[model samples]
Target chain A: MTDALLRIEGVSKRFGGVIASDNISLEIRPGELHAVIGPNGAGKTTLIGQLMGEIGPDSGKVVFEGNDITVLPTWQRGQLGLARSFQITSLFLNFTALDNVALAVQARSGHSFHFWRDARRLPELRVPARDALARVGLAGREDVVVSNMSHGEHRQIEIAMALAMQPRMLLLDEPMAGMGPEESARLVETLRELKQELTILLIEHDMEAVFALADRISVLVYGRVIASGAPEHIRSNAEVRRAYLGDGKKKAAGGHG
Target chain B: MKTIFTVRNVLVFGLLAFLAVIPAYADVTGNTFIMTLFTRIVILAIAAVSLNLIMSYGGMVSFGHAAYLGIGGYAVGILAFEGINSGFVQWPVAMIACGLFALVTGALSLRTRGVYFIMITLAFAQMIYYVGVSLDRYGADDGLTIYKRSNFGSLINLSNKTTFYYVCLVTLFATMYLVWRLVNSRFGMVIQGARSNDRRMRAIGIPTFRYRLVCFVIAGMMCGLAGILLANQADFVSPATMHWTRSGDLIVMAVLGGMGSVIGPVVGAVALLVLEETLPHIIAVVGHFVTGLEMTAAREYWQLVLGPMLLLVVLYARGGIDGLLRGGRRD
Candidate 1:
């Protein structure tokens, strides 16, 4: 547990009548892609939010690198090496892709109070931004404004932003949400390459990517983790099958069998 | 790098050149009124530039920016009334006072978004306005007359009208240059990022509130400089200087010019002020020709013509006049 990069212990959050995160507890070890797979409204995003310090838990703690970060603000969590990408493409729509990644680099570099120097011309920031963009296979599209880019590119930019921070762990909320098959495959490969170096808590609906890339998988259902184990273990678990994957497979079989 | 030969750049530079030569033009034509009008335009352009920093780049729509103008003016007026007429003392005091007020109000106001943010800023400005109204010792509601302009000693002569106009014109250019550096700098990038998406800014590890608050204070102090110039120009300070409507005019100037660029607000200030001054006479002439209405009566409704013009600019030119000059590019 002490070796875990992030620990969510007994985290519970309620929105009036409905519970968003009910007694959710999970751990992400160093250098592992731990994916949280769930159906819509299954508290997966809420769990990610709690880990990223955006939402407060009703009762529990989010321990990051052995520090209790339950009361820390979102930016502090980021400073402590926890970065997140939103489920919805949250970006500076007017700025270029290079500018977006460069901002992430700027956040990690130091205070941004340097008022006179042109930030775009800073090689210290631009170099890393370029490297991150290249890592995401977006080499030549650096100057494209975010709003002008496709939805899939926005998703890639989100990942590139997280990668640019060089965080200890990444909390990705549906990175492949609206991606085409080719884009998703590319992302899966990127995540595979990434998991070899960095810790990732991936909240994704793409079952193929989740099953293929996750070293460990947790099945969240109605605000609770019904199963937590290796991907093969989660795939064969009867409760998880009945709750999520099995139900989907049954519907597919009925429609096409 | 983008070419500097674009239409917007040409217009901006041309306007600067025109401002620089206005005093000579007035001297040649024996038209002192032209100099005075241009001076006011230059001073208000500084205020508009400051407003654009927060409104356009930082995404903070403050409805009480004129409060700083009032504060800055009062700092000068009150100091002069108390017999401290030194420019060195008055200007810094005005800037500091404006910064403090912005810090306090911005701390509270920035917590709210959209309409609430607008209302809180308006409320704070109104509070300052009433305070200005209640300063019974310094001419209260009617306002205080500055008997003498802040003495700059051997640095410059404030008594010379042409000298003062040049002084204001220089300040306007300096302020624009300062804002230009700010928006393109690291600090500016953070502020712009916050404006584009504040939540994403925090998610990426930049504590955005503090950056925004700093930006707000910077804007306040810059506008305060304009206030100092305004008071010196009019030789008067009143509660009306910080009135909410003045704040609205600043917003209009920024929006009308083009909030996207640093010089956009200056253009807006020039366009708005010039239209305000000329619209009545133009309206009177047009009305006389078309409707046979009395020139005086027609002139009273110049705002009717101005309102539709502003609406057209807002609807058709999303970036304002500067945006149009940039060939309709959004940013």
Candidate 2:
């Protein structure tokens, strides 16, 4: 059997009597594009937060690379090869795109306590940042300030920042949430290219993109995983049809949904 | 044309050149007091720069910075009063006191943010001020006087006015350079990221609180060094040195200079101190011409005009003197 990159077993979370994740168990293998989908407030974001060590599961364990990391802090998990992007675009709007990515590269390198040389002037920090930006199709835009970028481009930079960390598996939350059809199509193509090289655990609402890109799909509702399978199996599963796609027209959308 | 004169770059190089040359000209003219005055400017600028590190970059506004200054000054003064005049003994005690205070205060204050954080820091500084007032041997509320400067021997004679001025200048430049490097370092990036969006930084696997707290302590320790030099410069230490209002003055300096860049606070310190020195003179001269008013009376009410001037700076010159001189170039 292939080594599982991420294994979540019986993980549950509660906030003041509200269940965010209810004993959700799932495994993501290396180099696979796994997608998580749910209706609004289905605990998708909370589950991603628990995976990145932003929130601890009330019960159950999160094992990554065969090591239990349920208690690790965020940065430690980051160092151990887990990287995530925000559902909301969060960036240093005051800084140039190059500066933002350069900072992430700096984090993975040695100690940043060196006080004399200007990091901007250092070629080591800039080279990898340049490479990361190029990978995200933002090569010439590195000098542009983040505030000046369009909403779609800002989203792209967010992913570029995560890519700069060079993680084993990428957790992307709502990567195409706010975009025009053209922008969404472009991001879909980019993810299609990236999936060949890196394992990705994506949470998105665009059913077309989710079905087009996800190697496997997991359906979440009211904080529990209701079904998990390949696109064909999930599409044919009867309960998934009733619980998630029971809205008659969406059910007609068939495997596309 | 705008590309050639970005507000951030123009102000940075321009200020460095001016600081380097001011003392050189003053020295040639034998107006040595200008050197002393500038030295005072440089030392406090160091503290202002430290405040900017946490405030502008880390997104933490602390009103208790002057407490570290007073703690550092008292460390030197109390040690001196007890016949321990060595720089070695005095400097480390000042740093340790500031660090200890910062660690405790940061632990409590970091739990709160925004206006609550501001008020809590102010309250802690006030507590320190009161403790300074109760030190009877160090002159209590009246203050402690240092009979001699720190003994660094042949390494640098701080007793000589020019030498001391150079020392302050070097330290100020060093601190500015250090802060510039810090804001661009990996740790600094995490701090800035936290400042920009703490929720996002945490989502992306960056633990933010520990970085912020460390930034807080580093800022406090830096201000402590400023306090040591301040006591040495004035040859005195007192409760008044650490008053919460004094912390207000440091904040004003950082804001007035422009908090976006490392060198802005230094420019603010020079502008403020120079104005403090020359405003009374201008007021006295104008008063003498207008109403034949006595110089002493004109001097006493100098603050009347000073308050309005600062208000104007805050109103019209939102970027402060650096911004004004650079023609409103904002980063």
Candidate 3:
């Protein structure tokens, strides 16, 4: 726990009598790819929302880099080296891929009160924007408007925008939410590479990617962590199988090469 | 991206050329009424440009925008009424009053979104309008006549028609230039991003409310400056200046011109005002020609034509005049 890069300690939330997060606790080690998997309404998105400061927990602490950031605003959390992408593809649809990434790049640089020079012309902002896009395999599509891009491409651009923030860690909420298998496979590869460089707390349902990429996996059901362990142990856990994996454990084990 | 020879660019340059030579054209044709009409359009165009900053670019549809214009014009009028007739003092007062109004309204109103925001702004504008009507010393609903224009003294004279017209025209151009610079800057990007997806903006670590508030205040100040110019242009100030309908007119101009482009609202202002000025004459001429009778009443129905033209623009020309010229390509 002392060495954990991010920790959620007994966080609980209720929405009009519905228990969304019930005494949830977890720790993500630095440089480890931690996956939180759950069925629909398992409060996976709620967990990510709490981490990103978009949702206020009814109780408990969210400690990032050993700082209690439970009440911090979302942007302040970003300033604290935490970043997140949306589950439903939230992006500046009117802006180009580069423009979207560049804005994320600008947000972390300094005060954006600059009202004179053409922002697109600034190399200082655009250079890092390009690098982030390139890192996410979106280099050639930088100038394309986000609305014109494919769903997969939008997913990639979302990751690029998060990367542009240059945060110490990323809270990715279903980066593979709507992707096709091909796009999902590409994203898995991208995530595989990114896990080596930056600490990632991923909430996803893509079983193959989760087993292949997650150094540690937590199973959540009805807003509570039922089990947490490494992929191999989680795969064999009798409780996890009964609760989540069901018949899919055999496929997840044999399905991936 | 706006390549020099695009149809939109040509039309913009043509409009600029026409505006620049209106005084000269009026001189050659011995038709000074055109100058008077265009000067009004030019000044109102400044107001429309300010609205566009938050409307088209920032995605903040302020239905109460006319309140600033009223505040600005009243600042000039009240100051002049008190014998403080200096242009320097009156203009700054107008801007400050408008800025303060925007700060308060924006702080409260920006907390809500969509129709609620629109309704709150409208409510504020109406409150100011009735306040204007209730000011018995300022002539209330009957309005007030400015006995003296803003005195610039040695710098320039506002009473000279040609000079005032040029002044309005120059100010319009400067406002356009400023908006052009602002919409392309880093600050502009945040405003646009917020408009596109505000949640995404906050999730990416931007305190969107502050940026939105600043834009609202800047827009208010700009409209306030236009109000000062408008008061000087008319030598009058009235409560009707801030009426909700006037705010609607600004919105119409923004949508009619193209909300996404900087010059779209200016184009809309020119088109709507010019049509308002000339349609009566056109209707009178056409009615007499076609009916072979004195059909003088048709001129009164000019807005009948305007309603449909706006409808057509809204339906088919979603980008407004600028977007139409750009063949409906939007950023």
Candidate 4:
């Protein structure tokens, strides 16, 4: 729809004989959390890559705020307020948590051609970076080097980096991929608060978090979106249950309450 | 700032003071050869520092860095041969030439990664080396000699060995200061981020390639300045100046010194060159004492000792000498 903040229209991608994305069309509305649920090898990550401009779609248009940005470079897309967190936890391991988030803030400030001023000493970058870290419950851990931090804490830093950019929408690929239950719960709580202000497209295997936080759920199977609608509609959709959510029904039900 | 009195700072200050007084010490001892050797060390240290900018921070391992040294040297040599000897004109020409070479080669070479990048850079340097060989008018492989040093009007005397040594020392410190400022700046953040993860850097709204190319050009220009000093120091230029082995030596200097910090490469250049100067005599004495071998024969096998030492440093001291001094602390 024209009101949709991000719209993917019939995007398809092929890798040799494998179809990574097969006519995948979806929409993310403003201030809404959209969760895409899929089985392993369902090309969920490929979808995120296409939207983030890392992978080219064979046939389709990606419209953001009614602008066709299908072929824009990844950084230009990011400049247009589209941000992403890696599924495999990519971070500047040598840098401190505050330094990592400040880099994200620096990316959005302008062209970083500054060659003399110490970037780490800037209050403008540090203040927002601190606020984002505190929002993710990592207030006191800012000075910890990322390589030394726990895996769950790295995920939180990932989110803090995305938030520091003040992005219009976030494409998060498995933000809770390696997190424990306690960390998952903490992240779910953070997302609940964030959903009030930001648009998010979440690709997660955790059904409980998906059912609890998603305003609308889309079920993808083998690069195809089988169903997309309200959470209740997706839960009852027979095809979605048969293709992807069969074993997750109990967890989804528990989360809904 | 309170950590300024740390062991590393003290050692660094001690080294700087030692360098500053080398000419005075030579004057007292009448051992002018020491001044000449130290001047070469200081000039090459600037090149090593430039290499560290791309290798350590930008994660670009160029194997053809010596090509810039040759380019800068040849810029002076060729101009001096043509009867143009002004430092102002010759120096800028050398820097611009090196920058242009870097831009063209970097555009093609950066398209590949890992060993491919290394090989491409090596190939380009070899190509330049061959071009140097083909310049028969400039003495080709026999090399070209500059009859006079670059003329700076009333500025300073390059003919004075002591004055030239001071100039090289000043330039090394300035290069280190510039690199320190660059790596801490906003531009440096983007460069380091790209080095850590190029994909993530692009996703985070940094047009990484352009920034990296610019970095490559800056490093080339800096190394070119070192080349100018080296040509002036020796008053000669040859194709061998940018030989692949020379490139390898620059890489060794960076690795040996500690690429993580600005001063590490300077330490590395001094250490490697000084070891090269003294290791043969040390080997001869040790060999004569241990196994009763003839001193000259033992000196011939000096590399046998140096090889294992380098291996030990690579294996045990992964961060090089600078890392060893820091005791595993991050720079």
Backbone clash numbers for all candidates listed: 0, 0, 0, 0
- Lowest lDDT sum, 10 consecutive residues, model 1 chain A, at A248-257
lDDT of 4 by residue, B86-189 (tens): 99999999999999999999999988888999999999999999999999999999899999999998899999999999999999999999999999999999
In candidate 4, how many Å is residue B215 off? 0.7
Task: Give lDDT tens digits, candidate 2, residues B1-331.
Answer: 3566666567677777776776787878988787778778888999999999999898889998899889999999999999998887888888988998999999899888899999999999999999999988789999999998888767778788777777877888888888888887667877888888776565455667877888899899999999999999999999989998889989989888877778889888877778889888888898888887677667777778878888998899877877776667556
Question: For model 1, how does the per-residue alpha-carbon lDDT over A41-141 read when each residue is reduced to its tens digit?
Answer: 78887887787778889999989889999999999988889999988899999999999999999999999999999999999999999999999999999
Instruction: Tell me the spans in candidate 4 whose CA falls farther than 4 Å from its real position.
Output: A248-257, B291-293
What are the Cα lDDT values of the candidates? 0.92, 0.85, 0.90, 0.92
CAPRI-style quality class for the chain A–B interface of candidate 3 = high
In model 2 chain B, the worst 10-residue window by lDDT is: B198-207
How well does candidate 3 score on lDDT at residue B54?
Answer: 94
| CA RMSD, predictions in order | 2.5, 3.7, 2.6, 2.5
Docking class of 4: high
Off by over 4 Å in 2: A246-257, B1-36, B203-211, B280-304
Which 10-residue window of candidate 4 chain A scores lowest in summed lDDT?
A248-257
DockQ of candidate 3 relative to the true structure: 0.83
TM-score of chain A of each: 0.96, 0.94, 0.95, 0.96
Candidate 1 lDDT over residue span B1-331, tens digit each: 9898987788789998998999999999999999999999999999999999999999899999999999999999999999999999999999999999999999999999999999999999999999999999999999999999989999998878999998998899899999999999999999999988999999999999999999999999999999999999999999999999999999999999998898899899999999999999998888788888778777888899989999999999999999999888865
Please say which candidate is ahead in TM-score: 1 or 2: 1
